[model samples]
Target: MVQLLNSYISLVIERVTMTDEQLVKECVSGSQSAQKKFYDLFAKKMMGVCLRYTNNYEEAQDVLQDGFIKVFNKLPDFESKGSLEGWVRRIMVNTALDAYRKAKKYQKDVDVDSVGFMLDSKDFIVESINADDLLKIIRAIPEGYRVVFNMFAIEGYSHKEIAEQLGVTESTSKSQYSRAKKMLRKILIEKNFVEESERGH
Candidate 1:
């Protein structure tokens, strides 16, 4: 009985795998049904990516739609070198950066020399805060700083890559990241999420 159940599960998995590949092939061939299936599969995750790059809900939705359009248009180039989802994610990231550049919203120049020192160990107190609250504070940061911070800290982009993508200098990226950290620390401190330590009077 156990063997029969295991065989049944394995067959179900195999059928699902075949269906996914068929869907992709049909989508590449421009089948509307497959396209709908692809959208249903990825829209939620893609929307989360869009939200991270945008300030407001409307802007996020616009970016999401734009990203999906790009994905569909570029589906022919997707040769399965990597996971289709990762390719889609890269497209979304690039689209968000492009939107940022076109809007002239991010800082063009950064004063590297003016970068401040890192906060002290005692000052890094937001570690105790909940993840949701921390995300709220991050979202409150200015668009330029927030994008840089998300790319570098959360999304793991290097300074050089960020600078190249945003059309700024590496030092500028570093400075923005530093400024973001300092601002986050201040915000968290003000919110009493981090306790103040006593120093010598």
Candidate 2:
């Protein structure tokens, strides 16, 4: 009877839907099951964020684990003023930046590439190269250019915010971003990954 009652209780508990707030509260209260649920909810998206900031799959996995540790430790202090996923995403981004800084990945001086922009970025977007190809090209760029491009163009961070996070001057951030775009444009064009169009634009 006791075992049957316990199983029944567990079944009832499992059927209950949890909002993010409730999941967070349960996690904060030391519920192992709740913590598992919390990790499952955000792990994939967080891993994508980690991958963008890392050079390869293994390093990205390392950053993902480190980011989750910080997330779990600091979660209790998470105020409810903003979306939980946004808060967690910010934590992951900061964790990646910290790892990058520890590895001394910051560039002291990156001159903008002088490649002329023969292709509009908008034109490249409509091509058939696919997302994985795009990611590969982004990863092939130098770390300084890659990081600035990811921050400013993809993450919607202003050059000023990227400058602060990267410990570079705003002009440096802008220069790197411009260099990343021009260099990426040149590579994609040379690779024939983009649609054929007149180059005079």
TM-score: which candidate is best? 2
Residue-wise C-alpha lDDT for candidate 2, range 1-201, written one tens digit per residue: 999999999987864766778888889999999999899999998888888888899989999999999989998998778999999998898898888899876975655445775445575474677877877888888887888888877777999999888887999898888777777877787777763464535
Candidate 2 backbone collisions, by pair: none
- C-alpha RMSD values across all candidates: 5.0, 3.8
Largest lDDT belongs to which candidate? Answer: 2
Q: How close is candidate 2 to the true structure, as a TM-score?
A: 0.83
Model 1 TM-score (2 dp): 0.75
